[model samples]
Target: MTGSTEASLRVEVLGSQHDRNSFECGVEPLDRYLRMQAGQDARKNIAAPFVLVMPDGAIAGYYTLSSTAVSVGEWPVETVRKLPRYPLIPATLLGRLAVDRRQQGRGYGRYLLADALLRSLRSEIAAFAVIVNAKDGNARRFYQRESFLPFPDQPMKLFRPMADIAELFR
Candidate 1:
């Protein structure tokens, strides 16, 4: 498609028809997960992988969402004080996210992220936030730019409250 833009992209559940082999975001772990484990995870109900598809059916980017939990103690005191006294808080894990190397600079990462957050917010299951474990400093910075906050003790692990994310879409 000529004059293509991110708006022209569509996000859908990853399926056998989607070509995962050619998706490379210059990250080996992320690439391998998508190509090998993503389908298995989906089948096992461990995670739901969504792919950003071009008009020609090429996979430009993908992300996985799964149910998770975090200890209340892991949250900052200021944040935890307002929350329930439960030992663990429900969350949605953004397990893996990556864009094809060719699509890296085209804003597909953020686009996939937005779609993931919105999906989490819309889910009937209760989740206080969306959490991500950044693979490195650069990934951490990326999530931080999108308003994700690093846990006080775990800089690579970050979260953005569902309420705040809801406000973003509104």
Candidate 2:
């Protein structure tokens, strides 16, 4: 994969057999959570984690996503009136995404992100958008560049509508 694309790498749903003790993404919380808590979260139906694995079975990167919602007030009044008057709008939460330090510059972050979006778009769940709670300014920028817009009053949180994502697959 050195001189080629990541076409050979595959994203696997995290499971008991996958090695989690050795995954190190250079971020304490991300690494710790993946090693110690992602499984529990998945078991509880809170969020599902996916890991990118090279053919040799090394963990390259991972991301977690779960069902969530946004308040109608999070959007502009014009948009609110057009949607259901429910207190919350359905969404998929891209909770966390991180690349192992060794795989940092190989575009695995983007790869994982594209995979997450594709999964969200393909799901039958009722989601109006895919949302992310960016950890910092840099994280926010990444999502913004990927076409996720900031909610009306939140700069650190962003979202891309499901309709927009659906258009990509067509």
Best model per TM-score = 1
Q: After superposition, how far is residue 108 of candidate 1 from its true place, in Å?
A: 0.6
- TM-scores for the candidates: 0.96, 0.93
lDDT to native, each model:
0.94, 0.90
Clashes of 1: 0
Where model 1 places Cα greater than 4 Å from the true spot, the runs are 1-4
For model 1, residues 1-170, the per-residue Cα lDDT tens digits are 23466557899999999999998999899999999999999999999999999978899999999999999999988999889999999999999999999888877888899999999999999999999999999999999999999999999999999999999999
Residue 24 lDDT in model 2? 92
Distance from true location, Cα of 146 in model 1, Å: 0.6
Count of residue pairs whose backbone atoms collide, per candidate: 0, 0
